[model samples]
Target: MSLQDWTEAELGIHGRVLPVMQAPDAVLSAASSPVDPADPETVRLAADLVATMRVSPGCVGLAASQVGVARHVFAVDVSGHPKARTVHGTFVLCNAVVEEATRNEKGREGCMSVPDLTGDVKRASRIAVRGRLPGSGEEVVVETDAFEARALQHEVDHCDGYLFLDRVAGAHAVYARQTYL
Candidate 1:
């Protein structure tokens, strides 16, 4: 099924809001293992990611590693962001990969894990991603632009064990967050 057609309820699980792991945590820097999308545990993790992201203000996406799980799973929802275009609503993907990325642009980005900092990083303004749904394990391809693309790339970076800080041009591009999100 397409990501647009998928929903959290299909997982048949209730998710708990997991604590977001902070940067410098070993798990946040370690690459995640691919998960069996249809596995019960993977489904539950996916749900938990969504739940956690929902409660974190300004969190448009989340990954398993951010929640202290080193697995290639994440949830993303950029529906109402000012820069979002072609949003797919809220959906989880396991073993996601960026198939194509283009139109690089620099933008300020913040993370729940790196709560004290924000950075100006260059990211693709358009992208195409491929992954499997949490419950049914159905493969889906999502093509999007603007903030949705940025959010997908950010979560994908998490799955690969990289943070926004890693993508910044230099120390000059990083700054202390003035306000808490």
Candidate 2:
């Protein structure tokens, strides 16, 4: 099924809100392991990710590593954001990769894991991503632009063991988050 047609409830598992690991945590820097998307544990993890993202304010996406799982799984939902062009509602993907990326633009980004700061990082304004669904393990590709693209790249970077801080041009591009959103 296409990502747009998939729903988290199809997994038949309810997720728990997991504590997001902060920056400097070892798991945040270590690359995640690829998992069998159809595995029972993986499905639960996918649910957990979605639940965690839902509870966190301003969280558009989340990765397993951010929750200290070290697996290549993440959830994203960019609906209602002013910059979101195409939205897929809420979905989780395992072993997601950017199939294509273009139109680089710099934007301010924040993370639940890196709560202390936000950074100005350049990211693709348009992208195509490929990955597997959590329960069915079915492969799907998503093409999107604007903020959703940026959110996808950010979560993929997290699964790859990189944070938005790592993408910043330099210290000058980083700033202390003045207020929590």
Candidate 3:
């Protein structure tokens, strides 16, 4: 099934959103395990990733570790963000690997796990990622640029036990998020 179709189908069954595991959670600092793409639990986790990410404001992606599952899985979509130059509708990946990355640039990034802060972190402006689809065992490659690339890197980092904070240039690179209405 296409990513959108899979998301739509899963949405009905997993309308329940999983809670985001916040910072200071040990899971966030530990490396996650590789997930079997064909497992039924992978499908359930994918659904939860999508559900949780969708409900969170300004959230473009989420990793399995962020939901207390230390597995190499993540969900991402950058379809409508103002900064998004390349749009990938919504999709989940298991055991994702960054095949290529180029053109490093610093960008503003934040995570649901670390909700109080945003940081300037250097990331590739373009990247090629390879992984398997949840429940389908289909190998897929995602080649993207701009915001999508940054989002991909951010989520992949979670699977590797690193947060945007770990990539921040310095203490001065972090900033408190401003609240406004």
Candidate 4:
């Protein structure tokens, strides 16, 4: 999607989080994009994020940036319960925000672009996210934490040009454990 030239039709996204690095960069702004709820391109992007989530290793979610767009969007599917069916509740969230975030929790995280690094990062314990479902004016809010919270915080950062590597608490906390792929 051409953030500079693409119109509302050619580019499915209004604005994406990532720029040129295959995925979105960390975002700082907390504003949502104006998406036409009924546009097919918008719907397809959301579905693309969801599909990417399923195929990515060590990935529970994906933001628009990861897909090389710079809008305010992402997708997540972690219905596995950490033990059961690891791929269940697939979701596509567009123009998203955290209405209310509380406390702080730290955990290990990795990005598709930052392939060599996976490290511990701090995030909110509980976050209430609000965003419009593609092609629909109806807005939906999801309360998430744990891995979900980590994923939401991580994706939201892409909107403002922030990266998990920046959030690494210390050198000891960050790791280049493996090149699994």
Clashes per prediction? 0, 0, 0, 27
lDDT per residue for candidate 3 within 95-131, as digits (tens), equals 9999999999999998999999999999999999998
Candidate 4 residues lying further than 4 Å off, grouped into runs, are 1-34, 81-88, 179-181
Candidate 2 yields a Cα-based lDDT of 0.91
lDDT values, one for every candidate: 0.91, 0.91, 0.89, 0.63
Candidate 2 lDDT, 1-181, residue by residue in tens: 6687656667567899999999899999998999999899999999999999999988999999998899999999998888898899898999999999999999999998888899999999999999999888999898999999999999999999899999999999999998835
Error of 1 at 152 (Å): 0.5
The estimated TM-scores of all candidates read 0.97, 0.96, 0.95, 0.73
Model 2 ranges with Cα > 4 A deviation: none
- Error at 135, model 2, angstroms: 0.9
lDDT: worst 10-residue window of model 3? 4-13
**Which one wins by TM-score: 1 or 3?**
1
Candidate 3 regions with alpha-carbon error over 4 angstroms:
2-5, 8-12
Specify the poorest-scoring 10-residue window by lDDT in model 4. 1-10
Q: Write the per-residue lDDT of candidate 1 for residues 1-181, one digit (tens) a residue.
A: 6687566676567789998899899999999999999899998898899888889888899999998999999999997888887889999999999999999999999999999999999999999999999888989999999999999999999999999999999999999999734
